[model samples]
Target: MALSVVMPLDISGESAKYPALFEKMGVDFTARRCTTPEEVVVLARDADAIITEGSQCPIPREVIENLNRCRIIAGTQIGYDTFDILAAAERGILVTNVPGYCVEEVSDHAMALILACARQVVALNEAAKRGEWGFGPHSSHIREVIRARMDALGGKTLGILGFGAIGRSLAPKARAFRMRVLASDPFVDAPVGQEAGVEMVDWPTLLRESDFISIHAALTPETRHVFDENAFASLKPTCCLVNT
Candidate 1:
């Protein structure tokens, strides 16, 4: 009998490609649009392997304990936080995830947002749409545009909350615009920050010093609500924050 594989997520438009791919690998593949732990238990109980699609389709401890034959659980996304790793370990089932997924794309998007905020791009675009052409000094809307006051990125400070892969990738990009970069992460050392041309600082220092702050931290208990009311109050009045 061929080994069975089950995917417990609604893969949407990518449904057609999975069966052919699995068949070529000599495995019996089944895709279920499972959105709950009960659904996962029913669909993957007897499978040899399971594939998941990040936190959206959680495979909790209950589901892991119910699996009678599953030997591996592979996550298609970068984070496997939703998986019951301890339960899988007890059952001798390997848990894995794609760590390099979207590193560049996420950093690029963060940079785009930083630029937009510095230039007041959205506000200016909205003003233009309202027939407020404020380019010329004599235009009636010139005063409004002057009040918009776009700041230059050069000589500004950018603080990165998590100095992991995506944060490292964003450092040089910010440097190209002549922005000073600071980073804070317990896992990353000062040498790594120096190598990336960024200052290694504490979280409070990063919050107080940055003109623009970007968050690249993983979603976990410790990282959640990091920017609470106190943190918000610490930021400069003109500071811009981006998370993408």
Candidate 2:
């Protein structure tokens, strides 16, 4: 008999190609979308593999305990915080996630946010829409505000919170704009940062020196709300933050 797969999420339009792809691989599987835990328990009772998107549903202890023949639980997100790993492991089920799936896209989005904050793009566009031309003597206030906020990217320092795939991808992009990059990741080695042309620094050093900071760290007890009141008080008043 072929393997049975159950998708416990509403991935209709997004996963239109999954059926064809699995068929091409000669895997005869039945993919069913279960929106709730009760539905999942019913549909996946005889399933061999369970697939889910991290946002829609969480694979809780109850769900794991009820799976009859599940061997694997796969997530389409980088983080598996939604899944109960211990429960799955106890049931002899492997948990998997795709970490490097959106490295470039995420890095690009972070860079775009940094650029938007630096240039005050939204404020300027709104001013233009309100019939305010930032030119001549009458617009001195606008020009002064722009001059006070806008700074060139070259020679600026960019600090990254995590030195993972997305952070590594962003370092080179920052360097391309003639900006210095610093990273702080307890899990990564100094050599990794050096190879990516980023200097490994302490969290305080990165916060104090960087003109812009990009956060790429996962949400954990240690990293959750790392930029608290004390951290904000240490930053430069002109610094911009981009959290992805």
What lDDT score belongs to each candidate, Candidate 1 first? 0.89, 0.86
* Model 1: residue 95 alpha-carbon error in angstroms: 1.4
Put down candidate 1 lDDT per residue, 195-235, tens digits, no spaces: 88999999999999999999998887898899999999999
Please write out the lDDT profile of model 2 over residues 1-244, one tens digit for every residue.
8787877665477577778887887665565666677887887788899888866877888888998889999898888878889999999999999999789999999988888887788777777776666686556656878656877789999999999989999999989989999999999999988999999999999999999999998777799889999999999988999988
lDDT score for candidate 2 against the true structure: 0.86
TM-score of each: 0.89, 0.87
Model 1's alpha-carbon lDDT is: 0.89
